[model samples]
Structures are given as C-alpha cells and as structure tokens.
Target: MGIKSALSRPLAAYVVHRDRQWQREPVAAQLRLLRRLAATGAPTAFGRAHDLGALRTPADLARLVPVRDYEGLKPYFDRTQAGEADVLWPGRPLYLAKTSGTTSGTKYIPITRASIGNHINGARDALLHYVHATGRSRFLDGKLMFLSGSPVLEQHHGLATGRLSGIANHHVPAYLRRNQLPSYAANIIEDWEAKLDRIVEETLPEDLTLISGIPPWVQMYFDKLLQLTGRPIKDIFPNLNLFVYGGVNFAPYRAKLFESIGRPIDSIELFPASEGFLAFQDEPGNPGLLLLLNSGIFFEFVPAERFFEANPPRLTIADVELDRQYAVVLTSNAGLWGYSLGDTVRFVGLAPPRVVVTGRLKHFLSAFGEHVIGEEVEGALREAMTQFPAVEVVELTVAPRVSADPGQPSRHEWLVEFARPPADAAAFAGALDGALRRRNTYYDDLRRGNILVPLLLTPLPAGAFQRHMKRLGKLGGQNKVPRLSNDRALAEGLVENP
Candidate 1:
C-alpha cells in the first residue's frame, strides 16, 4: 500500500484521521477539535452551550447537545450549495447521496471527496474483513450482485453522475467491473415487475460466490429465483458461501436466507450508510459485528438510557462501554462533524468492544406512547420461531393502530410469512405477543388496558415479500424487503384471504 498524495483531499484526510483515532482512542488534540465542532453542532441542534473555548477532556464531549434530526441541518445544506457560508460544517462539498429518508422522501445527502473515499474504502475493507473472518482468500467464484436503486440520476455539476454515493458500488472501482450485476441495467428505474424480471434473468447463473445487499432485496431475488426456476438455492448457486447484508436487522430474515436457500452460508449483518461503509460483521461462528475502527471515519455513541432523558452522556471512542446499547453518531471528514445518525447499537462483548445492532433509534412505533422498536419485534418473532426451528419468518411488518373507543389505546397488527408454515398459527402468534410484552412493559400495559389487544397475526398471501419486491422494483441485494410499514395495506390485503 502506498500513499496517493495527488488524491489528497477530504477523503485522504478522513482516512488519515480515522487511522490516527484508531491507534489511540481519540487524543487530546482530536478531543479539542471535536469540542469546537460539537459546540457549533449544538447550537445548530437544540442546546445553548457556547463560549467554552478550552475543552480539555472527554467528559466535555459527553455534554448534551439538543437533539437535532437531519431536518435541522437542511438549512445548512441549502446555504452550502448556494455558494454562501455552508452553515453546517463550512465547505463546498463534492456531491450528495440520494437516500430514502425517515420523512418519506428522497434525501440528497452531501458527500465530499472524503465521504466518497470512506464509502469505497470502507466497503472494500468490510469485504476483506469478511474474507478474513471466513478464512477464504478469494471470493468463492463469480459475479458480485448489488441490489440498490437506480443510480443514474441528474449529472453531477462537476463530472459524471450525482448518484455516486448510493450507487457507486456499480461503478468507480475497476476491480468490481469484471463481475458485476448492475441491477438497474435497463438504463432507467423501470416498472417494478419489469425490473425484477431483469434481476431474475441475469442472476440465474451459478458462478456467484457471494451475494450482497439489503436483506429484503436478497430475499426478493431468491423468491424470483425459486419461483422461476422451481429449484432449491443449492441447485441454483452451488458455490455461494456468503449472504452479506446490511441496512436492517437480519434475525427476522435469517430463516429465509438459510432455509429458502436450502444451503449453508454466512448471513452477515453490517452497518453502512450513504456517508460511508462504517462497521461490519467481524467474528466468525459468533457472527457478532465489530467496527473497522481504522476504516475511514471517527465514531461516537450517546448513552442509550438517555434516549428520553433531558440530557444524555455522549461516549467518545474512548468512553464507549461494551455490552450497553447506545445511539450511534459519527464525524466523517466528508464535512459532517459530530453528526448523530439516529441508529441504536449495543456492545456484544468487551475486549475489543464487539457491537451488535440494537435497533434504529428512530423508526419505531410509539402510537400509545410505548416505544415499540424493530429489534423488540424481531426478537420476539425469532424466539417464538425457535420453538419450530424448521420454519422461518420471511417478511413480517407491524403497524400501530388505536382502537376507536374512549379509553382504548393502540395495538399492533402483524403480517408474517413462512416458506412451509407450521400447523398452528394461534399458538405462535400468542407466544410471540407474550414474548413482546415480557420484553417491553409498555406493550404489556397497552394490552392490559385494552390500549392494545394481543398482537394480530395474518398469514400473508403466498409470495407476499416477493410480490412487494416485484412491485417495488427490487433487484438482487440485501435491500429487498420492505422492512417497516406503518399502514396495513400489505397486511390487510392478506387478512381477506388467510
């Protein structure tokens, strides 16, 4: 490895900074820079802490900044592109990643050269980490599949495409070109059904050693693969060894990947963003995830318990504790400083602080003021399914509905699927609901008060995830499934049948 000083820019600085941070858990110099950045980010948030110049210790980083979601930074982004003083960090960035945000619209996330470097390098490093973990030198055999959205967007002001941050996997690196399944091969975001046809038609080959993307997208590919071919996955991709996934939890979709594929492979979970690739599943057999601390960004965590508190402790890389769930935050050199991304994570064990994704800090249901998260629901579903390990919970989404009565509160209605379902539905749903209530007291109270009735379970129409995937134009990737849905359209459509 050699230094490309000519490529020195935001990305270079970020990679360098990340390496330094890893060698030593954030040093005093880095802490000072962080304090100044946090102070600026704080006022941008809800807090009023200012004028404290000399931030000497890690404790200062722990001081609470008024919680600010991505919405708070929109103004800064607008000003930056306008050639005005970019209020957020202070730079004219390179390009932006078009991400589907929490507010139900496409979010154009700014990315500097640094952000781009982090994403590419982080992904490469993550792949390499997987290789090391599995003790394999070469990726099993054939092409690498990417299940992502149409990356062809408006041409970037500087050069080629504005979709680089999200779709760069399809381009940028020459190494990826030899074996690539650009899911959006039609040169457009075609209709969902047509798109899946393209995906299915291209992926039928058996040379692929690894398949990667969002879990839903991966599941979608398999559904089409199974339906069109009518063969077990082993018959399709006999050489497949890794089912690399990210963007959401894998526990719920675990059975689908392992059972439907009907073969053995690594169902790995990773934490990546438009900002950068970030963390990945590091330990083998354990399958527990760890941050490539030296990847390309700095990391931070806000104490999970402070989730609703007026003030919460922020954990610097130095202060982060193992085994405790916390809110994830980052400060990549892409001009994003001390940015809180609103994802929840927990340390799996100490030693090197192996972490497991707890859940999304945002993206939860609290209709009756009870915070019901993805992790809680998935845990309950997985535990209940363990009673019948032979079956898997393919695609299950929950919606919070309040009953139409004076004192009634909200309840959860679930839509679930199984490859070959078990004989009993009533017992499974009951057991799942019980596990949920036991884990979350708010859920128990809701049921007790009739605020929420016991969980309603609906066996979806055959191939629901696949149907949604086809409708959504999902291709091959870890991104196939519609992970969370608030409305009951998918569930209700099934109720009339099962």
Candidate 2:
C-alpha cells in the first residue's frame, strides 16, 4: 500500500466505527460524551456559574445554561484575555482566533491545545472519508495546496491571535506538511496579493493533486494561473483531481470554478469556524454533511424562527426533526459553552443525523415585510446568471432602496462587481428581478401588487468590493460579500469605494 492508503486504512476504519456507533445509540452516545465534557469543565468559572457540576443529563444542562451570543460571553473572554487561568476550559488557551463575522464585528475565539487537535483531526477525517468513499488514494501521492491565511500570528495579551486559517496553518501535520505547497516563509506573508504571487511562484511546477480553499479566493488563483500560464488548469496540473471548499456556498461558483478546471473533479464541503470544527462531507453522493456528534463538541439547536426569543427552546441531538431550520449552538472543548454560532442549518436526515447549512441567522433582507434570505438571493442570482453565460460575478450584494417620494415604490438595489461584465446591464437586472419573483412567493406578491418597483442594478467598477473589504480590514480568506443585507450599510460602503 502507498503511504496515504496505508495511513488511511486505520483512519477510515475508525471513521466507520464511529459512524456505526453514532447510528446505533445516537442520543445516548452524544449525551454520554456531553456529560463527560461538563464534568471536565465543571472547575471553570463558566461551568460553576451554570452549576455544570450538578448537571447530569442533556436536559439538565440545557435548562441550567442559557444560550448566549458572543456579546453575552465577552466578560468571560475578557477574563481569559487578562491571563486568568481555567476561566472557560481547563487552562490558558495558546491562542485566540480573530474573526470578522457579519453580525459580530470582531470576535476573539479561544483556541486551546485540545480544540486545535479536534480541528486537525476533523479535517483529516474529512479527507480520509473522501478516500474511503471514492476508492481513490493515488492522488495523495501528489502535493496538496491549501490556500489559507498567513501563518504568522499576532500576539494579544501574550497569546497568539490570527485568522482560523492562519492558526490552522501552524498545526499542519508533519506528514501532510511535506505534501503541502508553498514554503513556510512564503505562507506567512500578510499581504494577500504578495502571498498569492509567492504561492504561484512556488507551486506552479509542483505535482498538485488536491486543492483546498474558500471558493472565491481559489477562483482568483485559478484565474491568475490561467492568465500567467496561458493554459487551462488541467493542462497546468494533470494530477489535479479534488477541490475541497467551505466558508461560502459553492452553488453559484460551481459552474464557473468547474469551467476553469476544464475537466471533471470531485468536490467536498466542510463546515468549519473559528469556534469549532462542526461538520464535513463524508459520503460522496449525500446532500448533507454528517453531523459530527462525538468530535469534542456538544451540539444543540434552536428553531430558526424562534432564534431571537428571550429564552428559546434549545433542542439536543435527539429532539431535532428533519426538514426544519435551526440555529446551531455548541459547547465545545474550545471553552465556548452554550454559545450560538450565528449559523442556521436544516436537518436533511435523522438516522445518521446529516445537515446542510441554510444561511446566517443575521443575514436576511426584510425591508418591506418580505423576508428574503441568502439562499433565495443566491439561488435567484445563479439562475439569472445562467442566461448571461459571458458574465462572471466576482462579488455582489443586495439592499432595500426605500423611496423618498410617496408615489415611488421601494425597490431592491444590487451592487455587482463582475469579472466578465455583462453585455447588457439593464437586461441582466431584469433577469435577476424576474428570477427572484419566480422563486420567492412574498417577493412575487410584492412585485405583482406594485408594492415594489423594478430592482436597480449598478455594475460596480472592477475591484470595488475588494477595495471595500480592504478598507474594512476583511480583505481575503473566509470573509465574503454579504448577499442580502437588511439595510444599505454594505451597499453604501462598496459604492463609496473608489
């Protein structure tokens, strides 16, 4: 057996064992593990505050610990950052992952040694599961390029702090490190353009088989590679066979990204965050990711519709029903207890418990009593973009255009930065408006009643969104354009960019 196949044998076996274990006593298995976590964490200030020591069951734990957002938990985080030991977890964390979430301006997610181990293990399991399902291990013989943030972490309160990708870069397994592209020095450069240029310089000739990154940035690299080499990706790297991505929905970019590849390649999705490694696509033909139950995180769900309730009902692994949207909550080894991740997902299955990310809880447009979410907007845009095949969307956002005059009805405003500008902007906007009306009943009703006017489309100058992101200090890697903002904050910000 080759090196990767040999290593994956045992790992795949473990994954299979865990899968079976989860299937045969899903609730009991999860509860048993959660109790152990609570017991271990009982000595911490947060645990004691919630009386975690006395909690013996999932129900008991849920009843005692109220769900909290990052703002609510900031006091505890402040304590930890001030060098207090055993505040949330067992000891002082080695680093804090800095993330700029759409809702939360800036969050410092604690990263413990134990939690980082889970992150690393979860990522490996995802690949191993891919190997097991596809019966393809030879690709592992070639290099794997991870398009990630810089490896250089900034120190905060004597502890390292950086993007989750940057923090993860520090923990690349020794075995995989040899197969990973770009030298250590080159990977640590902070400027994204500079780092990408260095990566291209270092990896162009390497035998890259697997590529992993958020879809947009990866797409950028592919565009640059094709521009520089004057050859399709398949011609540049014949060994390329896998594209693993997450952080943004791949539906809109799937066609464009695949076209760049110029050949069929398998793709996998991951649901990872700075707080924890949540889920990964395990089975190839499956629609949803396997909900990782035993992976160092105790999972909970609050109904999406009731997410903002003063004390919404928090459901455990056993209580979740298929086809219902829920806000994801977690108490993980990372020291975050009863914390809402601000993400909404729907359960597609219950037997093995699989889920698909729906959208962000805070990311919805409800300007005129018509609640349109990220999924709807993106789906509409993707459907409309099909008609204009020549137009490639680099970035886009939508906001309500409230009319100043009573006679003029409100409309939706779209600020789109296109890589391949459309042949006719007015026609493109009409197609998009039609698509949205067709997909969403509320939007259709509004349009039919003349409650809303035809949507406004502004084709932004190239790099407008990038310049806006740079100004906000959220330039690259995991930070994406908010598809449906309730207000014009994002739209105005991008429009103001020169």
Best by TM-score: 2
Cα lDDT tens digits for candidate 1, 1-498: 112212323343454445445445434444655655554444332123332233334555444323455675566555665654434443456666766566746656677654566676666655555454454634533666666556665644442334442356544476456566644464244454566677777778637767777676677677788888899887787777777777777777777777768966865666777666667665566756656555445567888668667666667666777666788776655546446787888777544456777677656667776777777888888788888676676677777666777666456877777766767888888888999998788878878887677777767766766665555444333333443455665555445444
- Local error of candidate 2 at 169, Å? 1.5
| TM-score for candidate 1, residues paired by index | 0.80
Alpha-carbon TM-score of each model against the true structure: 0.80, 0.94
lDDT of each: 0.62, 0.85
Q: Quick one: best lDDT, which candidate?
A: 2
Clashes of 2: 0
Instruction: Tell me how far the alpha carbon of residue 354 in candidate 1 is from the true structure, in angstroms, after superposition.
Output: 2.5
What's model 2's overall lDDT? 0.85
Candidate 2, residue 190: how far the Cα is off, in Å:
0.8
Model 2: per-residue Cα lDDT at residue 464: 85
In angstroms, give how far residue 170 of model 1 lies from its true place.
5.5
